[model samples]
Structures are given as structure tokens and as C-alpha cells.
Target: MDNDEPLEPETQDEPETEPAPQNSDETLYCEAEASVAVDKDKAARESSETDLEIEDTEKFFTTGQRELYLEACKLMGVVPVSYFLRNMEESYMNLNHHGLGPNGTKAIAIALVNVSNNDLGLEGARIISEFLQRNISSLWNLQLSGNNFRDESAELLCQALSSNYQIKTLDLSHNQFSDKGGEYVGQMLALNIGLQSLDLSWNHFHVPGAVALCNGLRVNTTLQKLDLSMNGFGNEGATALGEVLRLNNSLVYLDISCNDITNDGVSKISKGLEVNESLKVLKLFLNPMSMDGAVSLILSIKRNPKSKMEEIDISNVLVSEQFLKILDGVCAIHPQLDVMYKSVQGFSAKKALLQWTNPMKLIQGYADQHKITVLDFFKSLNPKGVMTMPVGDFRKAMIQQDKVPVNLHQVRELIRKLDDKTGMVNFSLLKTVKP
Candidate 1:
């Protein structure tokens, strides 16, 4: 017999059997099975339909809804309100028959603030404040970044912060708050003690605004992380803020990028770091610092052996090989000085030209010929100091020399060949063509 073949019943003598009985239990079992099958099919259909509806709803958001959502995000410093509301509605409906949506107002009220429209993100704040007033013990996280907020709007926010104590994180980045508006918010920070992370980046917080904020930081101990990037604070402003950092021990992360801080500003901050131990991350990108400023910072890092600073950014500052060597030496010695170099991005035309002039391969070859490292040769050329030269001047200087440095010409030829192959070079080569 084949292993896969079906078995056949064997013929045998059979006995007589009693007739079947009609009972309610049999009827009920059959009905229950049928009902279960129907319910399963309905559930499958409903689930598929719900998924399709959610997809369609995602595709159908109106401009008004998007604006309202963005505004709510700026005021409350959280994810878009619509997204939060949708999830909250689903949760509420799943938990109870509370159809808290367009279908149920009470459910909607319980789940969402319904601030569909209104300027300065006040409606959402008002709703959240009102909810807290009713509950008295609920915790919330508010993030209101990238909204166009004016002075009047900031006042309402101050009022909300004055009363509410549950909100822990408040992000107010990218708002159009000037000195007056920032002062109002600063007042709130001074009195309110519940906030931990306050992000005020991309606002118009100039010197006056910073001074006002320093008043709050001086008194408030609850705030731990503060971001003040793209606010245009210069040396004086940073000096004032540094004074506050010197005294305050709660702040850990300070971001001051895109400011007009030069060597003087950095010097002031260095002074603050001398005593300040709580600060861990300090961002100082897009500042007008030369090698002098950089060296000063390195020296300070070396001096302060007990500083808690783990990372430092000196990007976009005019730096040289000497600066890099010093930083390399510092890293070798300290092992904790996490220094970052200015990347190729946003390099000035002059800087880019210089990089093209003195390619790294050429420098390495020149150093090899001189029986020393590239760093030593660079130091020898400018014994006292080497300022960051412009790209064009550096290129011209390299080519104008009597003899082209070893490997310099070779690297340039290689770059030209690659550029030609990639269709990037449309001009004639600078030097004579070599095989």
C-alpha cells in the first residue's frame, strides 16, 4: 500500500441504534457556533475598514487643520495636537463607549482641548490649564516650538505657567519673541518651579532678552537644560550669561550657536567654566573665533582638569593645522577633551580654495620629503603663528613657488582626472599636463 493513500473502511456486521432526541441544548450549540462565525467575519471587516479610513483621513488633512496643529505644537511644545487627539480618541473609545470625537462632545472634551484655531497657541494652553484646574494633580508635557508668537500671546502663556504646576517640559523655540516678550516669559520662569527643559532657540532674544532671562536663571533651580541658539547674543551678552552660569549649578546643557561670540565671548565663557561643574554639553558653533580664541579655549580646557565639560564644538571658526595639532595633543593627554573640527560644510570660498590648494595627500608627501610630520613643517613655516589663510591665496601661493612641492602636483592631477571623469571640470588644468 502507498504511504499517501487514504484508508478504506472494512466491511463488518452492524448493530441496530436508537433514534436521535430533539433537545434545546443541541439547538443552542449550533446557534452559538453560527453566531461565533458571523461575529468573527464582522470583526475582520470592521478592522480592515478602520485601517482604510485612517489612511484616507491622513490623506485628507486640510491646510487649516495643519496650521492649527502647528500652532498648537508651538504653544504646548508637544507633537501636533491632531495626532495626539486622534490617538487619545482611539484610546478613549477602546476603553469605554465614550465616543469622544465628532460623534461625542463629552468624550472629545475629556480627551482633547479642541483648540482648532486661534493665534499665539492660547486656545490649547487655555484648555490644558483649565483641565489641570479641574484635576489638580495631573502631569503634562507641553512643547510649543516653531509658532509665530507675539508679546500678547506670551502674556497668556505666562498666565498659564503662573497657575499650572504639572507641566515639566516647555519648548518655545522659533517663536518671534523680542526683548519685551522674552522678559515676560522670564518673569514666569523666575516664579514657576516645575519646568525642567526650556528651549528658546531661533527667537529674537538679543542682549536685553538675555539679561532678562539671566534674572530667572539666577533664581530658578528647577530648569536643567537651556537652549539659546540663533539668538544673536555677542560677547557682552555671553559675559552676562556666564556670570549666571558661574552661580547656577542646576543647568547641564547650554547651546549658544549662531551667536556673534568671538574670542572675548569665549574667554568669558571659559571663565565661567572655571568654576561651573554642572555643565556637561556646551555648543558654540558659528562664532567668529580665530586660532587665538581656539588656543585660548584649549589652554583653558588644559588648565581646568576638574571641568565636567565632555564635548566642545569649534566649527566654522578660522582654524589651522597648528590648532588641530594642539587639540590632538590635548586629546592625547586629557583623553576627555572631545573636540570637533569644522567640517567642509559652509566653508567660505577662500577656505575652499585653500583646501584645493593644499590637499592633505600633498602635505603628507611634502612632510615625508622633509623627514617630519605635516604638523612640524606647518609649525616651522610660521614659527610665531600661522593665521587661517584664504583658499585662493593658499592656492596661488602653492603654485607660485619655484618648485611644486612633492606629491602636490600629483594629487592635483589625480583630482583633475577624477573631476574630468565625473564631468565636474569644465576649465583648463592650472599646471602642465603630466602623464
Candidate 2:
């Protein structure tokens, strides 16, 4: 019974007491102050030389190691739910490893949840779409060419573009999109606000698809460079595109080569150029615009007061001397039209002759004054310097081998003499000589 009364007097000293005259709030304030002081002291001690003597530590994973780690996490069902959520701050740093490295397959799935809400079965597509959407403002040079994307994939891409307002350069070249995909992309362009350059070359956009794009360009004002080359747009497509150019003031460079465009197509484009003052570089090469079309274009250039065209490529067009004369006249007058002519080696020999004929004649006459004949001039013109004469009528002159100019009668006499001697006239030698 006595153990309950004197138990405390026999043992340890009592703890120290504080004066508590403060109100409830003040007491709480004091307790907070005491707690803060204790924490400060503990922090100071923990940061002392003893703790400093311990080595600082960090963890780094190589690309391959990170891939294995993420793969293991995925297989263990720990990545998509917990690992990614816990490492959001490091996600971007890890992206180079996961998105562009071996572990990219696993990291892309987790990253998609943050950017895209699409349930695309492929892991990278949804993730990349989302990343582009989120970083659209910073992705000025986005190159997604040769991605093997389908029409449905283009639809999803258009959906992303409809919401994004900051991508400036988009290279969608070498894709498998047809007119339907082009229509979808055209619709996106009609609504997109920040795109400046679009490369749709090598796509399969026919006249109908071009019409859709024309409709889009009629409204879009931010696009500056558009590459529609290699699309096989014929006269009808050119006409449709010309309609848009008449109204569009933002576009500066237009490439419409290899489109099978004829004079009618060039006419449509000229009509658009009549009003367009912003176009600088126009590529009309590899089209079927004949000499007449080129002459028409030269006339248009002469007439257009707003024609500030800096570069014009009329290569592969059937340009005759008349067309070149017109172009030279325009160049003499304007002096600003920088024309590019890609001469076909053989097909353009006539035009080349017309161009250098006067100079060639002057040089040849100077050489002839030194005893050079027209045959000698032809020999000099040929790469091997071997004179090959004309056939038929010229062959007759060859039979008369004497240097003296022979008349038709003497040519016949020589042919008969050769026939009598050899039983046959040497027509092969006749074939190589000029009249």
C-alpha cells in the first residue's frame, strides 16, 4: 500500500517547468516558436562537419540501362501508374533517353497521358502528338517526314493542329496521304493560326485535293512558303490554285513544277500573278508550256506593274528563238527578271544555236580568214573535230573529190567514173562529204 505514496521520491529528478501565464493562442505561438527553434538546432547539427564528412550521392542511368529499368517497371506494372507520376520533374530530362532511346517505347506510353487523350494503340504516335501539342510554341522546325502515316493518322494530326497555334515549319513530305488526307490538312490550315511553312510535296493530291487546298489558302493568311511540287496537278489544278493566289497576299514562294501544266495552266497562273504582289520565286519548270506559253509569260512580265518576281525557272519548256528574243527584250527593259534556263543538251541545240550563233559566226569567220572552211568550222564545233558531211544531196558533191567546186554535171561524171572503176560508187564517202 505504501508503494503508491512514495514511489516518485525514491527515484529520478522531475522535469523542468515553464511559466504558463499566456492565453491559448499565445501558448500555441510559444509552442510553435519552441518547435521552430528545435528544428533549427537539429538542422544545424545535421549539416555539421560530421554529416559533411559523409559522401553526397546521386543516381544516373545510362540509356540502355534506363530502357531495361523502364521495361522492368512496365512488366512489373509499376511505371505507368507510379514511376512516371513520381518522376514528373525528371520526365523531360529522361525524354531524350526514353523517347529517343531504347526505353523510348515504354516511356512514350507514360508520356502520352500527359499530352494526348487519344487511345491510339501505338505508343509513340499518341505521345508524339501530345508532345507536339504541348510544345507547339517551341517547335518551329518540326520534321515528321517519311512517317508512313495513314489517312486516319492525318486526321489525328489535324486535330492536334487545330488546337496548336505555334508551329511554323512542318515537313509532311513523303507521306502516303491522298486527296482525302489533303482535304483534312487543308481544313486544318484554314483554321490554324501560327503555321508559316508547309511542305506537302510528293503527296498524291489531284485536282480535287488542290481545290480543297485553294479553298484553305483563300482564308489562311499566315502561311509564307508552300511546296506543292511533284503532285501532278494539271491545268485544272493550276487554275484552281491560281484562284487562291489572286487573293492570298501572305505567300512568297510557290513551287509548282512537274505538274504537266500547259499554256492554259500558265495563263491561269499569269492571271493570278497580275494581282499578286508578294510572290518572289516561282518555279514553272518541267511543265508542258511551249514556246507560245513562254512568250505569253514574257508578255505578262512586261505588262505586270506589280511583277517583282526575283526568280523564274522556265526550264524544260519548249522555248524557241522567238521566246528567247521576247525574254531578252524584257530583260533589257526590266533588268530585274532573273530567269533560269535549264537547257536540254540536244533538244535545246536550236535555241543554243540561236543564242550563240552570232558569236559562233564571228569566231568562225575569223578562223575561215585563216583558211578555215565551213567544214573546218563544223569540225571545230564537233567535240572530236571530225567533219561529218550531210547526206542525200550533199553526198553527190563528195563523189567529185577535187577541191574545185563541182557542178551537178561534174558530180554525176565523177559518180560514173567511180562506178566504172570499182563496179560501184563509194556512196559511203559521198555520205560523209558536204555539198
lDDT of 2 by residue, 261-344 (tens): 999999888888777777766888888787667666667767777766655778776555456567767755444455566543
C-alpha displacement of 257 in model 2, angstroms? 1.7
Taking all chains together, each candidate's TM-score versus the true structure is 0.53, 0.54
Give the Cα lDDT of each candidate: 0.56, 0.56
Worst 10 residues of 1 by lDDT: 24-33
In model 2, the Cα lDDT at residue 5 comes to: 30
lDDT of 1 by residue, 177-290 (tens): 888877887798888778888888888988887788788787778778888999977887788778877888888778898889888988888777777767766788888876
Model 1: residues with Cα > 4 Å off, grouped in runs: 1-137, 332-334, 343-435
Q: What TM-score number comes out for model 2?
A: 0.54
